[model samples]
Target chain A: MNNNQKLERGAEDIFGNWMQASMDFWNSMTGRHGGMFDPAGALAQAAQSSSDQAEKMWRSGNKMFQLWFSILGEPENLSSFAKGAEVLPGFMTQTVQQMWESFVEVHKQLLSRSTPLGQKAPASDFTQPDLNIFRTWKQIYQKEFQKFLNVPQLGLTRVYQERMQRFVDEANLFGTALAEFVRLFYVPIEKSLDIMQTKVEEMIEAGEFPEDPKELYLQWIKVLEGHYTTLLKSPQYTQVLNNMLQNLVKFRNARNELIYDALGNIPIPTNRDMDELYQEIYQLKKKVRELSRKLEAKSN
Target chain B: MNPPKIAVDLILKKLAEDTEKVRIRAQKASEVLLSPLNTDIATTPHDVVYQEDRIKLKHYKPAEVRYSTPLLVVYALINRETMLDLQPERSVVRTFLEHGLEVYMMDWGYPSRKDRYLTIDDHVNGYMDNVVDFIRARHQLPQINLMGICMGGSFSVMYAALHPEKIRNLIATVTPTNFDTDAGLLHVWTRDMDADTLVDSYGNMPGDIMNLGFLLLNPARLMIDKYMGFFENIDSKPFVENFIRMEKWIFDSPAVPGETFRQFIKDCYHQNLLIQSKMELDGKRVDLKNITMPLLNIYAKFDHLVPPRACELLTQKVGSQDVEDVCLETGHIGIYVSSKIQQQFAPKILDWLKARDGSAKTQAAGKKASGRRKSASKAKPAARSGAPATAS
Candidate 1:
């Protein structure tokens, strides 16, 4: 064969080989093969899992809202009623629907971009598509997040606004943290892909064809792991993790406040009263135990 | 002439092989994920000897009791005692029984909202001491063997120190008595944590929240690589079953009592008061120098939770002449569940207890030698025999 024909064949061969290697990587991700180094797939899975968890959380919160409304029977009859009580259920339902849709859309987008970016040719011009994904994520995040800020407050004004506002604010903080966590999978891919692109092109120029896709994959994982491990082991990461966790408490407290407020209107006892009783009983038990021991010592 | 080049064909061949390998792996993984897994963990047979509120004292009387001195196993409050008996073959309790030791375990069952006010003083001095007294009285013995694991080990240490006369021998495994070291992330995190806010919000610290902290401590390995390893070895029934059992144990964490948690984090973790002997419970100080009993402090070499430095200083601080500090080459959980660790450590404990048991057995022999020689001879032989099988 002529030199030009051989070159053409070589190009076809190179592209074909890269395609097969990419498919192998993809297979590893979808559980079609051993997922030794499938961080992106794992992140997608996490996002999907979190989406489901968030839905369950919303459902539970709605259940509390429904129970609150049912207990009152006639909201208008109450002497001191929460103004937001009327719209709270519908508001929560609408907010949850928006949140779910927005989250799923982001998840779908993440999965779509993940495979395409991973399958890109090493010799081709690599456009860091993470920028696009981030932009899309932010827009949806902001839109859905704004809905939380408008949480139908009980009794309006400042009575229940603190919790409602804090819950929304915590969501924003947590969302930011979760976004960074998900980006852990993407950043490494982008960085490693850029580096690998250079290595592959150089090898081509030198007429050296190394069948080291597996090695390349392994190196990428090492790089990814190294970056994450450093971040995870840092004091800064600890603070961030703590911040995220603390916000969860805030969110819970806000939700509980909403429930407890609604429960207050009725004659039934609440957690506050239960807590006081428990604390009192606990102190009495300790005191009784102490006194019994002292009496036994005296008798002896 | 150049030899025939087959670079393209070679790529195709590699692709074909890879595809087949991938297909095989995919099928195996699917089978694993879809198939029902029967991971029967913590299945050792035992009877509840005593009960108090939520707490139950379990006596695992072997088919034949080998040793007269009963060893009470106190597990960490974070996890269940089931960890020691995770599997039959790898059970520490079973290994101890085979060696002729009568074992009793304290099941500090799920602490409810009512238990939020329970403190460390209540656990170590009240519940633990009560259990010890009950065991001593039941057997009509002066002292019984005491063994603690992890946080339970810490409580055991405090108990042994305060009431050293009640314990014959003390064994602490993966226990962090010295909480001052910056050995683990838990230490660093808890040091700066807002414990007041946390305890106030949750009343009882949720196990799931504690789990998150532990998970984050080694997220790269524990979260990512470990799961990757699981996916790789999904086809192996033994591996999968072991993995699931471990999962159950890890997630089966109990909410720590708020008062107990508050004191532990503030005094032990934040203030580093335990080792300093500055920690106080119910107006009494916990002085480590008071622990003069025969002590066996066993810690894992590669344990991230309670690092070697966290446990290595126990022998130094403790006023025990017979303190044997054993460092097993494994992680925290691996110390109990790993066959190699169980084999190495269980035998060591048995041998140590046997030597201690010898002194007691000889005294009883001396006391009975003067009277009824015929009956005494038979009783002497019985005492000499390995754990005697009684009505279990």
Candidate 2:
């Protein structure tokens, strides 16, 4: 191997040994994982487990809605068939109304639950019934988010750890931006339910059925547009946007470092070298402008 | 007759009509995009008369010269100034020339990686001063008219202050002078930004990054609603052309020089130092009191980028007694490109300049080239290296 490869090998071994020894000490201290213990690590593991349980439990609540929907949707016994037929449509309408109310309640929670500046919203916030009304969607969103940032590679290798850490930070920023974007995108549709509910009731009272639901959808889009504008101009939106920008810069720097390392071995002038040349020429031009002005003054 | 059947039939008919309309619209949209329509903008004639590195000075000569004093236009570095000459009907340069005035504009040019070391001092004091001196000598006059746009206006204010005798009439359009304002979200966000880290990482502020920030400022209006409006108007030929022209202008952003971007954010924005006179260009303080010329401060009443409040404080802080502030009835870019404003904006400047036009008038008034001699009589043909004053 060449000197660079050897140096990297040396680094990997040293860092790998250090990490292994650190884990062993932590295990001995906490008396877990066969002498692999850090109370912080134990606590983190416990926290992760509990959070998984909570998210699963919270997501399962959708089954309750489904159960209620099915029970009311179909009668178990035929003895009450006449009443079932009479009450089914009204029950379905009421259920839809209740679902909308739940969504609005969740929206209020999202608006009210404020995180301190600089901290990401807790992961629990993502899995809440308020955020995820449907099962398995948040999980999919998170998986895709990771895929976008690239899969986390395993090992104590310096490059792997660095890339993983950078990607994790990027994922956090993307989560915030995507949440805000999706929220605004959902607002228009969520708002249609409200207008549709009202319009349906008015039609019933007037003894006329609303012919087109699409018209209500269009109106919802308009309402959503207005809310989206307000959200876009909000201070919170600006903060999130800045967070994304800063994270983007970090990601760019990481990529630059990796690319520069590879490019250093090649026989090509990099941006850094070009920048140096530019700095030199820029300074020279300034000097020339100053000198030219002086020469003109002297001639005069 | 069954009421349900009638309702169903009516709904289906309505849907069919809408579907047919949309299909026709989509067909037209495809054809428009596929077939190249004339997307021409900024077609007015001009020559690159002077060069300093990447910077170019363009002069647009008129068929008739009514005024003696030539006006120099300075545009902001954030975007190109092609918007001033967007089209035949809406060209600011053409309007000024038609009004019988000689016009020269400063093109900050596309700054590259080599431009990272270009400080604000280099632009305001060095290049601007050189250009001003060149113009003064060309006319063999003591002072000429100066007009600055957006950030360029801020630089002009600083330059005019340092060399007040060189400028007889000063026009500052849609420029931000006072940095302390909460009216714009950009102001609030920049106040807390770590500009040092940003400049260190990127060297130069990437235009794409800046454009993203701008889009986020009003995402619904700029990003979503704008495209939706375009979709609604996609079938209209004129609308499509205008939309593409605007899109071209919006995206043709240049990466700003690193040193200049860094100092602007730190001193002018984060520190709120410009209006306080705490800003130093090349170790010399930028005092607004020295801008005591016949000042015309033009600002857009509804400009979101540079709010009216951000610009209104200039006249209050300036030391000029003859300063007049005019609030135009449009946003920032619209003041130049809007059809209604195009008819009025250039003429307003023309009238203002004619009143104070006698300073550069010579025995050869109304001539193609005015009496010369303090320096070169004509704008020098640009050289390849962009070295300053090579034309002279």
Candidate 3:
């Protein structure tokens, strides 16, 4: 075969191989090959498959590179090279479309599980969005993005990066805990509202609705108060509150660590430095008081 | 049987009347809001006699001192001492002063980041001891009356135990000595709290956070009904002023010293050591038997912060035979601020203090305590196990 013809064939083969590799990675990720929705397993499989496919693509790529160098050296075969590159955009579009479709499907699945008030729907066992919202987000975060943060760092900024990562993780955890805590507050409000609705409906049915609207408000508030009292004293509420507090403390400590590092660059003292000084001063004062008291006793 | 006929016209008329009333009220409220207001708190005149770091000794000397022994009032670190003298009509300090008693209050000024290391020992042994000694020396008396309010009362109990010779009478009002009962939400929630983590994260427990916690204790009443009451009477200048004053006092919280908070929660709430006489400070056990001075333990019956169950056990555990507990039908702050309850509370304290004032028995007790103080280099933990009181 002529040198130009050989170069064109090599270029086409490399494009085909690259497209196939991209399709295979996308397919594995979207579970089109019929496997459970295990992101970690899928990722491992995709990595292994891509490595094997990469070797073949690399060989073809090398041959194409050599052929292109030979053909392009004679300036007349450039149009053929340009023509072979036209397949790439279509493959890129297809991969993006598959990813979009998969995301939509996942979103639909998450949305299908529940009702807004966390009650079970008669039609299906789908949990509403508000129910376990944090858990859902946490699951996605741990599976998809947490590993990126867990990646080992290099060079002099390693400690700084690690501290940042810790702060970020703690902050996320605190946010989830706080969300749960806030959800408890809403529970009383929701239940009160539901009660109010039924009471009003009953009143309407009996034609005994109060003329004074303030009475209704007063009644509603009493209902709300009752619910809140029950909720505030509940073990579940206390557990959520403690969880939030603990998480908040962790977040604050993590944040303070980063601040400590940052403050090292500035002239201002950090809490740790000030705390040490305070401790010494406090001890010194205590000793002075003790000594003074003893001296007074002896003098008396 | 047929249902009662709906009166739509009556409902509409009532709604219109309510709207008109609201509009009129809003107009008057706007005028009230725009006008000058005297919402200032802690306005009772007093001089700062002694100062130690953030701690200050306030002397509220009456025109005529009825009692020989000056009463030193130690307030909690969680809030300002201003709650006693909230208003002219309902002032506890004024009542004490009018009854011809010498009053000294400890103003635990807002603690800063540096104050985080200050512990319960520092408060009781350091500041409180110095204040008591200063008062005793200034008044030329060997012993003074000691009264503590709420958390301050807890400190007073500790102080009276450690330095019984310096205290002729010990009055703990709305104070929490026992921590085993789950009668109050504070007792319940604090039992599980990681106070070390809280204090460590925020050097001194943030005042705003503490206030938020207090609000959570009764959000329905404090958060909702209280404000609703305000809107209902927004046009009344007097009501508005009092509401604002109370609001200022309630929200004006100070950061509790971190070490003190950690020790309190751990030693008292978690371990239930205070009433058990197992609580130790500055290497000395707070033996309740050492608190042999005339003890008057007063607590609010409806106090959600320091329930009666927490305070009632103190009189039983103490070494003094001359012990009395007055349980008032009031809430925590209500004991001080409620106009109706003020008559019962402050007068009751005055009478109790008066009855104990310079009694021969009290003097003998003080002398015995002085001997104990002179002989003992340190306090030994009490071995007697007192029966725990059930929550009412």
Candidate 4:
């Protein structure tokens, strides 16, 4: 075979392999439950099918690199190949975007199916708040594109690309921390409030005393408020506070009677010397007025 | 299993006899424990103690009023009014009496189911108006000092505003004037409550339901945590007694009249009309500006039900030139019963009233002295007029 024809055949083979490997890697990385993409092979299955897909994608990527290398060797035909090469980069970009969109759609479907029907539909539950997958994929694509740009000796775009990726990475971390906080801390405290309210109602029914039932309940709220106020000082705790406040309002509305009934029969002890007491109270009032007037005069 | 059944039957037979003995012992113990706490105000020990509509109001001689003006205490209809005179050490009524103020507190008798249709107008203008007239006529006094507690405080504020001429001084304790604040769950719920359903379903809202709602507001401490503490402290006789007393009081809820409840929720909570000076009671505009008498407003700072916000608004809303606002650092129930209030808040309240009275007395004395000087100076002018125009 002629040298040019051999080079063309090698490029074709490498490109074909690269496309297959990219698709496999994307599927493995995005697949469910740590993705075991290969079901039949016991050894591949043992590692996880997702990893297998990634491995296949990696091999395909190597072939694409080889094809690009082969094309690089033929400087005379580089102009003819430029058109196709330009299309390939655009195609990769489009494909990555499509993959991210598909991932979000699937994530939403899974979440909806997993959530119980009884709970009040949370706004966050409709769609995953964390869009880290798209963010990270976009970063990787930008990085790869920058490498392509470097091949053409364009150096300035690399700085902008890195800065953009760093911003996205920080945002993704923040979003992740917020979601984790809501799930772990906020949700549990909200549940605790519910449990606490139920226990209070039970105690009232059972007849516990010394402290007024209403006052006792107030103390509990004060404690909860203190905890939440402290929690709100942290950015991580902000999301939890939001969730808890929402739940608290709902809980309070549902159990409004518990608070009302707590003050139902406040004991008023009226066995006293009413005449003498009134006189003393009246005398005290006289004294307070005198003190106030004197203070006001002094201030003036 | 059969052997166990046989053993159970034997145990059951023995327990049957033992149960009667246990019951008798329990009954005796209950009798002994409850005897001290039981105050049969219904059936007075002596005939001299007369009952007016099943409430024991103190009887006074006609001559007594000539020396001292009577103080009439108006208690909230939701609970018994006995709280003012609860115990000798902490009784507000006792404090007044000790200061030589003739005290007359209205004990709104236990409202029957038929009384559910009664409205705020009926209580304030009807029953309350009649009681005031009765006191006035009996004492031959044109006006009297009015002290109100909780819901009664609101009623008293309304009455004072409506009939300014009839009230000498007004004292409101733990009284809520503003319902829009977020200081308490009651304020929030009441602000947005649908009173129609509550009032329509039950002619009078059950006190138990109200109690339950209050308990739910602070469940952790009110429910499990409180009982755990109670059980731990049950060994102390005084603590147990106090606990039982409070429990009994907590559970002994009185049903609120439906119409009154409806009006209170709509006019006070949802509309927030009271503090705005736009509330109409009995077709008369209750402009708080009309409350020009000396006013003493006391509230609990830590009160969960009626926060300081609810009570302090009274001083700001009323047009009384001599308005006193005192905030006690205690919860709602504690305001009335706490030893701290007895020592501090109650005494302070008494002092405020006495100071007003003292200034008035001094003014009267100064006028009398001036009248004597003028009469001696212009003896012929008094004879010419033939009308004894002494300084009032």
**What Cα-based lDDT does every candidate model obtain?**
0.72, 0.70, 0.79, 0.59
Q: Deviation in angstroms for B375 in model 1?
A: 44
Cα lDDT of model 2 by residue, A52-101, tens digit = 56545544554464444444334232224444576989977876676576
For model 2 chain B, the run of ten residues with the poorest summed lDDT: B383-392
Q: Comparing to the true complex, what docking class would candidate 2 get?
A: incorrect
- In model 1, residue pairs whose N, Cα or C atoms come closer than 3 Å (at least 3 residues apart or on different chains), thus clashing, are B64-B389, B65-B387, B65-B388, B66-B387
Note the clash tally of each candidate.
4, 4, 6, 68
- RMSD per model, one decimal: 23.1, 20.8, 13.8, 25.4
- What ordering of candidates by DockQ runs from best to worst? 3, 2, 1, 4
The regions of model 2 sitting more than 4 angstroms off are: A1-222, B1-14, B359-392
The runs of at least 3 residues in candidate 1 whose Cα sits more than 4 Å from the true structure, single-residue gaps closed, are A1-158, A161-163, A166-225, A295-300, B1-15, B21-37, B358-392
lDDT value, candidate 2, whole model: 0.70
Worst lDDT run of 10 residues, candidate 1 chain A, spans A30-39
Superior candidate under DockQ, 1 versus 4: 1
In angstroms, give how far residue B259 of model 3 lies from its true place.
0.6
DockQ of each two-chain model: 0.13, 0.18, 0.51, 0.01
For residues A1-300, what per-residue lDDT tens digits would candidate 1 score against the true structure?
999767655655564565456545544443432232223566757676665565556556655654554444342323123334557888889878988998899888888777766554332222335435655766786676765566566655666686667666666656666664455434444555677777767766665545535565566556555654555555655564566557666766777777787788898777777889989998888789889989999999
Most accurate candidate by DockQ:
3
Candidate 2 displacement at residue A185 in angstroms: 8.5
User: Judged by TM-score, which candidate is best?
Assistant: 3
Q: What DockQ does candidate 1 have relative to the true complex?
A: 0.13
Query: Per-residue alpha-carbon lDDT of model 3 for B99-189, expressed as tens digits?
Result: 9999999999989999999889999988998889899889889999999988899999999999999998888888999999988988888
Flag regions of model 4 displaced more than 4 Å.
Answer: A1-190, A193-300, B1-67, B358-392
* TM-score winner between candidates 2 and 4: 2
> Which residue ranges in model 3 land beyond 4 Å of their true spot?
A1-131, B1-4, B359-392
